[model samples]
Target: MTAEPALRLVDAAHPAASAEGVAPAREQERPETAGAQTLRRGLAVLRLLTRVGPGGLRMGEIGHRLGLNKTTAIRLTRTLVDEGFVLHDRAAGRYRLGPEAFAVGLAAEPSYELQRQAAGMLRALAAESGDTVFFTVLHGHESICLSRDEGDFPIRNQLIKPGDRWPLGVGAGSCAILAALPDDVVADVLARNAALRAEKFPRCTDASVLSLVRDTRERGYCLQPGMVFEDSWAIGVVVYDANEAPVASISIAALRSRLGPARSAMLGNRLMQASKELTAQLKA
Candidate 1:
């Protein structure tokens, strides 16, 4: 006989062998450990720098916030400087975010352009709907108001200035964009925001907020009645880029009484149309 097959020989040696036995062995014994603590320290430094605005930060301050020794913080800062993510000022003895960081930022600059192009559309929509219109973008698990157009109505929702950040799932504009995010990104954002949600948005439950997100994806818009403010309703549509990823959202806030079923439906349609037009214009 030629010989018994390899599977047969192996099975003969181990009678109870299964298909799993025939599979290739894992390349590595176990997953490699990551330098997560170091990563966290680095991120903490970046956040502290951001909080200090563009003025840069002294080494002592960065060390104090991170609970790191000055030498340790200096080592980390040196790594960041080498990678082009941060820069150190020799005379001032301070560190600031550098050009490499800005390069990564440029990739996300489309959202800012989108906001600029949507300004006029938002204004027209606000004028037509008699409600405040807001253009918002998702930034590090929060939604930031990038621009706004106030309606003619004297009594309206409180104005939100550009750069003001809101929890991702708190308002319609944010929820709409979060709902349209890639599934994995949504999960990551939710995981990262669990504590924040508990602190700033005690009224919102994970299940209810996720349900709203699912419904937003299905309905092509998000409508929240009294979620952000009492006696007011916020409605929003996701603003997509050429690649179809959600880059921003446009929201309309109106009095709950005026946003009856019929009026709400009308406003939703207008908001969606305006969002589409702006997306097209921005891409152009």
Candidate 2:
């Protein structure tokens, strides 16, 4: 989500698994050749379209970003259009990601299953807590929202929607995943996102984040106040994969007054239980 590919997993015995049992990547490197270079460039174009959000990008912007000349950009995009991986807007001259791209995304197995399984958990949690609930996968060094359900509470604290991306440690759900990551991964993510956090996440310093990680390790959840959306407080728990690796998180957000210490503990326990349920469902 942070300019990195989303994480998609398959079943333990999925065909793509190696002897070590990992899914084959959606994007694979091809031998270096003129044709392979063209294919990589075309894929890069599609990736860029995905990052630019729904409105997409103009040919000129795409060309400039990819360091391609206008002619080369046109040629590459023309091929993508013909192949249905890209959509061409005749009137606006913008190129957007097409249904083929979406189809390919849907082809990933476990992500859809996770989506289906987590939806009911999120709804049940939200209904019980009277707050907004979100489920996000740790995609690369970022957390991407997959789904959200609002509770009966009218004063909803909505900061992100499905498909929203934030650097790991940027939000409650993101921080929960970051805090629950292996120590090495936590260190690596902190180092990679250090400059970005300093520039953008003033509230979450290196020392503070490390403390949160320690807290999560000890207590099994993360509690952050006013780190993401202002005046919104949140508590979260991480969901692990079949191998017990942190893959995603489930979190609740609400007004500060609504999430008093007692209520926070109650909702935090609720989220932890739901996280367990989802973890088991994902593994299945």
CA-only RMSD, every prediction: 19.6, 10.7
Candidate 1 C-alpha lDDT tens digits along 1-284:
12211311112234344221111111112333457667866866765565455789888988986689988899888899899889999899899998987897789787477776777788888888877788888676877776767676756565355555776777789889889877888787777776656654554557767888988887788888765455667888888886777878899877778788788777888888887887677567
Misplaced by over 4 Å in model 1 are 1-111
lDDT (10s digit) by residue, model 2, range 44-122 = 7986787667788898999998899999999999899999989998888799988898899878755556667788778
| Cα displacement (Å) at residue 209, model 1 | 0.8
Residue 206, model 1: Cα distance from true site in angstroms: 0.5
- If scored against the real structure, what TM-score would every candidate get? 0.61, 0.69
- The model with the greatest lDDT is 2
CA lDDT, every model vs. true structure: 0.72, 0.75
